[model samples]
Target: MNHHHNPPIHHHTTTTQILKQSTTILINSNHLSTFFLLSFLIFSLRLNVETATHSLTSFIDHDPSIKSLLNRLHLPPSSSNHHSPRVKKPFLQLTRVGTLDDDDFFSGDENPDHRFFDTARNIKKNQTLLFFDCFDHLGFVNYSDNGVRVPELVPSNGKVEFKLSESVGIDEKIDADDIYSENVNEGVEDFLKRFELEHHEMSALLFLLGVLSASYGFAILGFVVTYAWVLGIVFVVVVNDLLKGYKSFVRTLWDGSNLGLKRLSGFIVMRWAIRDALTQLLGVWFFGEIEDQYLFFKIFVRLKLMPFSIVSPWVNGVEKEIYGFLLSWILLDTLVSFVFAVDAWIAMADTRKSVREVVKEGCHLLSLMLHPAINLKLLEGIVCGSFARWVLAGLFGKLFASAFQSFMEVYFMVTWLLYYFSVKSKDANASGVPFGQRELERLLEDVR
Candidate 1:
């Protein structure tokens, strides 16, 4: 006898599931076009093109001062006074709002978390307050466990200050002078001893884990193909860095300062990368295997242009060799990741850090990198972060991936800005003048 079996009845959706579905739909609908456009601009702009901008620029502006401040901050200042200590010092300061338009993604005003809001609210003009870990009042030799360096960024204000203290002090002798000198060394040492203790940068570490995960994944994908592919990826990243003199290829395209110009410039750079990759491939085919080995070494050297290298392994052997190389890569990547964490502080605190200074920071972080515990965490972080990014990409797709990637790219951008800012600050501090209205003009010209 034939028996008819009814298909299993479907269960009704619960309120929670329906809400989640609706929320997901809303997010996708709202941000799909926005992220898609950003991706198009970011990737497409990597190619260089000629662009023209009319006088009708949009009112929205990209004020990196706030974002830079937040990205570089590792912890709350030990002393609240550090927040605006320079207001008392930067006499005759030339100040602007230094605010980003609401539309800019980094603008903290709209964020519910209030973390960036505190930073955005307090920044004065183009100036930022920075704390130091390795240096003390007595400088290098006084490497006190508690030393904190609070350096301030003072922009040009079109006027100069002459220190009359020496002239004024020459005529007046104070009883405190002799006492101050006698106790100066002791005072400095004591200060260092009282400084805040060094600690881990949890936020920066988290950020670095995410970046290194992608870097690790990219490197693995390279292994799956050939080492040459990994070098190609690193080459693209480095080339993007070199092109920052054009300043279009870094950060989210939403800055939109010179939208068309950036797109064209980025497009040109992208073309060069494509051409170079093809040429390298052709050379490998024609010039023999030596081309592959040369390309591998070439990437290693070029990466030195930045403050630090990610230390990917040279995998060209069986299971034993692969395991050895992978272990070395993990150890090295741990140190690299720690340095990256310090870099967040460097980003906002001093946008003008030299590669030499970056090297210095990397050197300091070596102590942390050597710890056995952190070494293990590095491997775990890489695997977890890479998996998270992969799952995210699989779920949300290329647009989301591009947006997330933009955030990491900005971390690198901070170092470049640090190089530029450090120079600008040094010159301005030396000159003692805010270059008048010329200051803003100079920033515009530089970004262009």
Candidate 2:
């Protein structure tokens, strides 16, 4: 009998190790300033969304003392067997006493939060609590629909029973023309003339289009094609930007009356791109969905690499969320930004020479492909960017939402340039090339 025992798996510890190692590589690789600019421009929307979301959710106010006092008075539960909670608290009570017709029920007050908030007084025992304002008149009440007839709400034999349906007393004002104007643009001129409204509302309509473009468009493609869809989007958006940058680059390369493919590694660039996408997909899976108020971004910046905690303190409440984001961003996302900064400077110094050097470096890229963990971290930035594009764009603005998406396009090429140079520089150092003088001169000659 063969007694070959397979080793047991250690999942948690192994995952932890991988995360730590990946984090370290993210910090050590170059391009910090660029990452911070991208992160700040992009993640700020998420930060605001996080804060507003918290503020919105906190509108539900609960008074335990009042509940306990009522309990001591032996108040009977609204229903026998007490399956659903019917013991209404004082804060949830509504102010109006008179019976409301369906018209009154359908036509709710314009300012429910300000008027009906804590101002609601004594609740009737026979009456059911349908609407409530908990946070000092702030809007945090939930009104559910029960489908009961309107006449049923009138007191019957001193016993008032009302099962709440999602009926609120207020009707929201919506511009029908604004919604319909997209597919039918002619309606807008009439709408503006009819409503006596300004073009400011047009901004909102345009923003609405952006929302549809990002979400509807992304949902159709992002899920159906996955990675390939992301690639297509990046390609479409950055092709112009890359061409603009590449113009000066080409002029510098061919200025000497010679054009050579050896000066650029087409195969190497393609390989890196494919590998980078795979690494990015892995990073997205590793990081998972960022469900908790920018929690993933928060944890990444505070590590030894970024050190954002020095300027910011870790406070409790919502402020802690921001601090965590700053701290976490420094370690995980800064490397590529630093790499971009170096590449930009190098390109600016000598576009032609930089191209040749990068091609030379690209040939040796395989030798330095040992740090996929770092690429995983870089991919996380794109994930955050995607959230900005699809989720926050509607909440914020289209331009703001598109910032990171735009950054990712520019960033991929920049990082490629940096990666080649970093490896080539390392190899050059091994060959007794002075790290500070030789590479620095090549990188900064245009500056001089």
Candidate 3:
């Protein structure tokens, strides 16, 4: 123990070391505090800017006048005048009318109106007869009363009229007598005499008959050539081939059954079955695969070929399955197509939900970062206290940022949900079914 009071060198050295350590600790602490404060401030400022911009954008979007102004600036109309309103007319009118049964008006007797009409008709006939009688008694050979002989109405001379009237009256009496007798010979002689003189004057009628004869001859020739010869041979060939094929199919399906052999019943059944199966399966797969694009065409073909089958319970089930798969395929195709079609900004705008998810994850990270530790109890208290103070001061700012972000996310989610529900409701309505949240939940309940 060189107790020689050696100046306390070790103590001085230890004191200097302690001072350096304290200075370093103070500097580091100050740096860390400054960094955290700066970070918090910057975060707050950014949040405020973002929130203000979003609020401004929402205000502009919601303002009809602002939107109209933007529209005018971006897209002026080609014409300046406003269009006039269209005029329409009412066409139909509902009116009340009395109703009466036919039996009530008619008591099984001739209608009085019908008797009146017949009487008027008889009066008109009598007037015509009287006029003709006066013309005959005049014996003036009147045609148009002005002595102009109308070609089609050439009147007979007086002598000719007298002779014709006498002959006609005598013939009428003779005709009446002949009608009561078995031998009606009185008019036959006169008719023969008339025909003998008129037969040579009948050239016009003969010419018409000749023309008709010629036309019928040509028609007969055409009919023989077309139907009896050309079509007959074609019909024979087709019938023969059909009968041969039918026999073959029948023999294949039923070798020895007498009924199957008769009328080619086996062939008919086999052919129909094969055609049905092939058409049903292939048609369902091909048309149902491209349903959205080809539904109308498929429907037309199916209705034309298999209307009854399509309405059958079995086919209805098949159709539903086909349509369900088609709907799923179309949805997938649409999603894929949209992936290629959408612009970057639009896609990003639609990802507000994703941003919210990211923010939630960030909150978890922050919680982890702010977790308290037992080892550095005093330091933890100081940090937490300081953090709490800053947070309280900036609470509104933090909340504003969070609320803005959350609003965007909520708005996007709600919009998407609305769109999805609207489309689903429309489809269900079109299909004559009800769609609601309950239905949707039921559908998705078993999806996962």
Taking the candidates one at a time, how many backbone clashes does each contain? 25, 29, 0
**Tens-place lDDT digits, model 3, residues 28-66:** 432233223323433343344334334433444464543
Worst 10 residues of 1 by lDDT: 50-59
Root-mean-square deviation (CA) per prediction: 28.2, 21.9, 40.9
Instruction: Rank candidates, lDDT, best first.
Output: 2, 1, 3
Clashing pairs in 3: none
Error of 3 at 201 (Å): 99
- Model 2, TM vs. native: 0.23
TM-score-best of 2 and 3:
2
For each candidate, what is the lDDT? 0.31, 0.33, 0.29
Q: Per-residue alpha-carbon lDDT of model 2 for 129-190, expressed as tens digits?
A: 32222232222234233343333222212232344244432243222243233313433443
- True-structure Cα RMSD, model 2: 21.9
lDDT of 1 by residue, 1-448 (tens): 1112221111112323323332342244433343334434333322111010000011001333323322343222234355543111110111122111233222122323211211111223332232222223222342211122223321212121212223334334323344345445444333223321112333433453354345434433322222122222222232232223222333323233232232223322332343333333322332222223223222222221111112222223334433543454445444454444333333223336664575476445433323422443343355334344567669898446535544333323322222233333334445664322233233334323
Model 2 ranges off by over 4 Å: 1-360, 373-381, 384-388, 404-421
Error of 3 at 382 (Å): 28
How far residue 319's Cα lies from its native spot in candidate 1, in Å, is 2.9
TM-score of each: 0.23, 0.23, 0.14
Error of 3 at 232 (Å): 99
Candidate with maximal lDDT: 2
